[model samples]
Target: MAVTLTDVAARAGVSPATVSRVLNGNYPVADATRRRVEKAVRDLDYVVNAHARALLHATSGLVGVILNDIADPFFGAIARGIQATAAEMRRLVVLCSSSADSSSEFAYIEVLRRQRAEVVILVGAAPEDAAYRREMAGHVRGLRAQGARLVLCGRPAPNPHTAAASVSFDDLGGARALASHVVSLGHSAVAYVAGPEGRTTGTQRRLVFAKALSECGVSLDPALVVAGDFSRQSGVDAVRRLLASGASFTAVCCANDLMALGAMAALREAGLRVPEDVSVTGVDDVPSAQDVTPGLTTVRLPLEEAGRRSLALAFSGHDFGSPVVLPTELVVRSSVVAPSAASARRKLA
Candidate 1:
């Protein structure tokens, strides 16, 4: 039979209530009495029931993180910071992957709520659909009403009335800076590799890139605009189709580092040299961005810092209706250069 608090109490010659107070540290017991209960617990190998403790406190000591994909390095870095903060607070951190699916995201949030999670953080960009925003607002309100901290990271405000804190990087600013850098190198004919259209990251990044290009008096060619799923494979496939379609471009700007790497691979296979034959750039200067051949010149986002800040917001006892925006920096590397004259004349055939 499993050792119980009652067993420890019996062994200690103290009432079960006194043992509970000593174990929980909720009530002050005499120093000698505390030491006796501790020794009895050790002797009996007694374990406190977490479920019973939660019933008493109404919280499970859990901090839940919902991310798009755990395997993706983008989410991995954020999870690291969240883990570090949760450890400092002595809270159990659980990462739930949503696979960027609305249904899965909803289900995970609901499950975490039912588990009585102390905090629930939804990380990364949100879909821009009105239906999704409305439904998610309801869920966020529900979690808040239950006294659970709700944090939205790397996303725009879903509802002003919902009690949720927001933390996000400047998606528009980063993409614009990335686009301006590419255009400044005299790459007028540019190809845009973007995430899915419905997502805020994909749709907004593409719009800002185009807007920055127009501001620079350069036009992003419609024929060269390729939609990708923000994956390495998506980058490869997008470039392959662009090449197959006989598109003319001197530069390709991708939404994220992984897709940029994939774009480089596809271009290399087609005998195109980065920056020499064609210039390439990306957003989100992830670790792999620097390690890859030729290096990726991209916008740097404070991903890990965003993670830590979300936890801080959760515990601040105040809700942030507007997002707490984090800053972004441009990292110049070996991947981008002035487009070569030869790049413009080269034929895909």
Candidate 2:
């Protein structure tokens, strides 16, 4: 017979609600009461089999991962790391793509919760929305009560007080480093290709990128800032708009390598040369960043390591109430250089 919550409560000499509180760690329970509940759980040998046994190398249940888009290389690299770790533990992984939609994200999360997945990792940054926050708060509470884990990858935790584990790259610092690099190369007039508006990741990077340039005595002209959805096509469209509007800039800073590559293509279409007619730089030093003609100057994010660490945090009894900010590095390549003589002449004109 399966040991129920009532049975565990009876053995602990407490009410079912008390046992729930202790197990969920949502409310303040006396240490003694918590110990009694834990002891009862051990005596029943019910909860341990679902979790502790897995720590002892028993094949665990399903681990779910919901990504913005599995097709994007950014998410693919992180999922690769997660798959590697899950494979070692002989666990089955369930992967889903949410198409970067909140409705889809919540639906998949609920489905995983019903499956009693060992852990569910959300691997995208949803746009900031009040309704979504309220829904996420409810999901966090529900996941806690189910004795399952919720991990946020590349997204902010609903609240710092919650037990949700999160790991993200240092996007602000990377933006700062990349901006400083562009400023140092003597390019004052710059265009910025940003990601979707209201996305926490894009907002954080865009704000810092502009501020860092200002601190270096360069004003990031608001007229030159364009929004993209972190896609090559969006980057192409943004550049075409700038060209049509006759925006004068010596360089363009893209939000990611894919966008930068597209920007390079658009510039070539306009009869301009990279680092000669204009310099270009991007964040996320993915593998293809260096494969282009001039090679992209980008920031290297530890994406795979983030996946591995997030999974480790799921099983380890560590307090993950706050986010873990991994470091980022600036990689210089042939794509960026001092403004060329012809570009300087045009800027002055």
The C-alpha TM-scores of every prediction are 0.81, 0.82
TM-score, model 2 to reference: 0.82
Tens digits of lDDT, candidate 2, 1-349: 8888899999999999998787655798876676577657655754535663443232238899999988878899899889889898787889999998987887787667646787889897777887778767777765665667878888887665667888888877887788888888888899999989988777877887888788888988899999998889889999999988988999999988788888999999999999889999988788899999898999999989988887877877663655788999999999998988899987777
**Candidate 1, residue 267: how far the Cα is off, in Å:** 0.3
The candidate that achieves the highest TM-score relative to the unseen native structure: 2
Off by over 4 Å in 1: 1-57, 347-349
Q: Give candidate 2 misplaced runs (Cα > 4 Å).
A: 1-60, 319-322
For each candidate in the order shown, give its overall lDDT on alpha carbons.
Answer: 0.83, 0.83
Model 2, position 64: C-alpha lDDT score: 94
> Where is model 1 poorest over a 10-residue stretch in terms of lDDT?
50-59
Query: What's model 1's lDDT at 38?
Result: 61
